[model samples]
Target chain A: MTDLTAAGRGVRRRGPRTRWGRLRERGYPYALLSPPALLVLGLIAYPVVLVVEMSLRDGRAMNISAIGQEPWSISNYVDVLTDGDTYHSLWITALYTVISTFLSLLIGLGTALLLSRDMPARRLLRTLILVPWAVPGVVASVVFLFMLDGSYGVVNWILRSVGLTEHGPQWYFDPSTALAAVIAPTVWKGFPFFTLILLAALQAIPDELYEAARVDGASAAARFRYITWPAIRGTTVLGIILTGLWTFHTFDLIYPLTGGGPDGATETWAIRIYTEAFSFFHPGSASALGILSVVLALVVVASVFPIMRKQFF
Target chain B: MNLDRRQFLHRAGLGTLAVAGAGALGACGGGDTSSDGTMTLDFPTWQGDEAGVKTWWRQAIASFQQTHPKVTIKLQQVPFATYTDTLTSRFSAGKAPDIVHLPTTTFGSFAAQGWLANLDDRLKGTDILGNWTKVQKTMMWDGHNVGLLVLGYAPVLYYNEKLLKDAGVAVPTTFPELIAAAAKLTSGGVYGYGATTTSHPGTYSEATWMVYGAGGGWSAGEKLRFTDPAVVKAMDDYRTLARYSPKGVPSEQKRTLFFDGKIAMMIEGPFVYAGLDKAAASVKSHVKLAKAPFVQQPGYPSNSIHVSTQASKKKADMAWEFIKSLTTPQTQASYAQLYGVPSPRRGAVTQAMIDKRPELGLFQSVTDSAVDATPDNKDIVTNFSEVQKLIMDACVRLQTSSTPTATVMADLQNKVNGAIK
Candidate 1:
């Protein structure tokens, strides 16, 4: 047994398998990866450090010169946390993210499943579903503005003509419906991303599994539960995670739609950060709010990712 | 040998990258002086190509260049919405233009930060300085002459003659008469009043007219008293005016609807006349302009152009000369005619201008009485823009929600007090 092991060790140390070759193999992936790693360090990691540093300083109204002159303290974070507006904005952000992400994912999953099947005009429908995604966020929001206008909007006109009521709902003016109104356009613009990801996952599932299930006299629902859901669950979780993060940071769509007005009905954390930084000219406060937002996002991903990994993987 | 080759290529690539990055950054530092020894000055204005004003600016620049051959004026135009933010960013980066168009409300904040050059000594004995109006006194901060008003206009009543006549309502000259006319004209798809009652910045200016007219103002001395009984009453009156308006419509949309004849009357400035010619013929024939119906005092919602402190002394003098050229009688007349707004000079409105557009006469009548809506108390209010937003938020709350006027006013007063503190 000792002789056999010695022979195997000698075979492993053949020509061209020298220490330099082993070293190159170990360093090649890292060498290829250094450019992207440096890019992330410069663009993402460095800005994050700056944001944390700015939060600790006393900079307001583009007055960054006060950084060293003023004492570095946690006063900004304290003020933001103690403020009533911060809680209100965070609540709004939570509601907006949860609803928008769920709606976007649901619509995406349904459309992706439908498109995965062979149907008439499937190619054309697949191409056309991405129209909203193709349009820029600001342009999409503007189009929705005209479509939902109280006086001249096509939506109100349609609802009125259908005998829904004497007058259609004042979608933006009423706080009750304003959030839903804004979310409608957001989900519309975001669903196409999910559709693309989920559709690719759906198509990757083998045909033989479904055939075997059918042979076993399994119902369509059973076949879907066993074959389809398992096949696409991992992609679905990833799509939700991404869409949730994007929705949490939704600013461009909401800013033009309501401007965080109608008495702060739709003032998300992103809008609050903008108002603090640009409108109020308090960059320190804005940076504190930004760090809080990042922490919250990480907490959400941390809690959700583990469960999702275990369930799907 | 292979390692040496890889290291050489890496260092070479990095050197090239560093050189390229430095070149790009150096390009952003701005223009160099001409080899012929002419100084180039940047003059940024927010008016852009609106209402044929670009042509007026071009002619004014050409005239200035003819007189000052050693100076070159680079006229830059930024959009009105982002003008202040852009200027502030440029100022922070030390890349501010030699001259800037400073809106009256934001001048205090910039001047307080020492961004604007004082023109006191330069304009002391000049005829241009002698033409300064009492309203322009608000532009002064810390006992220095900071800026000069280039163009100014106040809100006035604009009505469709056919809509008023068809509704059998006479022209209103009082608050009651205007409210009654709006109620009468509320039938059909058309609304009588078209005030931009939203939380838009334009609404703040529009609402200030009512606040001032009601004997309510943003401040008395250095104390900002938004809870002043007069202000609460003014907000109540404003809420009534909005009831007759299409809810949540912005100023631009209001203008479109007014041109379409869906809105019978709107409180707007002389700039509205520029688009009158483009309105439907039916709407055009019925257009009428009148002074604001209920007003004891005129609101000064004017913007001025000023020399930036970042400019060299020599460049600043050139900028001042360019600004002075814009106010010359000839340039002012062309500005009023082409831009359809009142000139800042005391007697810049000529009979020829009135003949060209009769409605401009109404704007001219109010120029002498115009008062800065939120007059700055240099000791107390450091950021006029923040104060303006607070007041605007109060106005929006009162207009859009069922919040009690007194409650909103008290909250606003506390907020303003805190901001100033």
Candidate 2:
């Protein structure tokens, strides 16, 4: 009989085949993705687990031997919660994140709207707007430090020339201004990210909406409020959440500029974590503080996520 | 259908596990020791970043290698700002180098942590102990020798003589006079007095000199003495002088300002001499050195060398040998002559060396009364940097706001007490 005999019928219907073939057929996509998943577990998840485990132990500079050797307890978390400075730092971090994120989004949205229009040197301007974001955080901090220096900064020179005051304010040294000084650079560096994202979102908005709003006798503000705002709400919320998380953990920007100084006025939770671990050599406490910081950041992101989901998905 | 999906998921999960298992196995490779019966002793120091200082170190290392032919001394250069962080990370990873260039402020903490090898038994009846000053002896932790003094220098007041002369002001010999001179000298863009008032560790060191000069310190016999009347007075005096200085200037900026004639006076160590020598002719011509005006003899902040616990026993001995070699009179003298810094070894500053740089003589003269600024309480003292930050924060408040002195001092006292407790 031929291979296509009635009983055989096209190689006997191929039924499950070999076990290895079945496995490949079922798991090919997951096999292709396993390397990255493994990397994420190794690098990110492993360290996170270590940090959380460390946060549960009693550790300090004097008792390095006791680290992870002692019984695990919530004593570190208890101490962190009871400490007044911890709350102060947490408050500072929250204020910093909120103000910086708000200012960044506002400035980014304004710039995005401006640049989205038909303007002179539009492409060149769009490219140049990214310079701040492209600049390293430390470099941006140093640049702002020189500009706002009390003695011979260009900012001071400009203020003096304009007769703003007799002596320029100590932007970095005064408690009242230190946070603002650090925030200025942080916002400057951060807004560009917002601008790029929001600009894309604004461009995605169809031109017909604006034309329709204009035909209905809407003013610029009215059009922005009705058409543009609705179109970009989801992107704006996402941008703020992303930027807020980053600004909440902004150590490099603040450390180089004010070092969270002028009596710890700028000492946010992130700075506290650094000082605890590096300066005090107490990784346990630092880890505890770090965990708290992450939880707070996650809470902020979670609260914003649902709104984003509802607006978009 | 559900059974097939479950099997597929189980296999995919196994795929992830297999990848992770392979990675863990790959990273589990062992650390191998050197073959051919040669031992490598790694020595990490911040001085290697300095061109001149690095030259001196390379010479020292070469000489050390010549004597210890079987041991190779590897020099690891780290930046000063991140040196502590780097050292701690190395220690945590169990890969610390054999020799560590320890800062005085951190020696006690490292020793307490048992990261450093005790040199007391190792160096018994040795001349290294006799060579160090009383201040250097404080490097011992719990009566065990933890660090050997490597380089020592007392901070002194560096001034622009031209600016003082033009202002018709004499060199201030007392704290009040210094403040008055600063006020007089602070006309135009030039500040009368300059010290780093930022949160840099050097800021704490410089400010503490003023406190020690005022007969105040962080502790007296294990008691928290930060709120002493003397400390308060010193803080007020600093605040006054700070008014005449540009606010929020860093250490390097202060040095540059002094060199450029924008700062009439500043507090700095012997390192300032080198910086002055590098300045333009006008700035260099205007430079002057004076003993730091203090009621008590101010402590000389010094750096020490320690053998790491992570080193093997033989390598530790070699590391100790290398540290001892650094403290020799000959090496100390050579270092002083080349780098213009004072040596911790007594009598290491030769007459010829002093004649070469007069500032060396001034720094040497002040060494006799140099005290350790570290608090006597070992428990709280390990957190010296935190204390320094607290004091610095209070100083900032005193300068930036019209806070009552008593209120500020009380707050500082509370903060310090809380930290130590």
**How does residue B62 of candidate 1 score in lDDT?**
85
Per-model lDDT = 0.80, 0.81
Residue B377 accuracy (lDDT) in model 1: 57
Share of real interface contacts recovered by each model?
0.22, 0.64
The lowest-lDDT stretch of 10 consecutive residues in candidate 1 chain B is B374-383
- Worst 10-residue lDDT window for candidate 1 chain A reads A59-68
Note the residue pairs that clash in candidate 2: B213-B295
User: What is candidate 1's lDDT per residue for A193-307, written digit by digit as tens?
Assistant: 9999999999899999999999999998999899999988888898999999999999989988887766677889998888777666677898999999999999989998999
iRMS of candidate 2, one decimal? 2.8
The candidate 2 chain B region of ten consecutive residues with least summed lDDT is: B29-38
Q: All candidates' TM-scores?
A: 0.90, 0.91
What DockQ class does candidate 1 belong to? acceptable
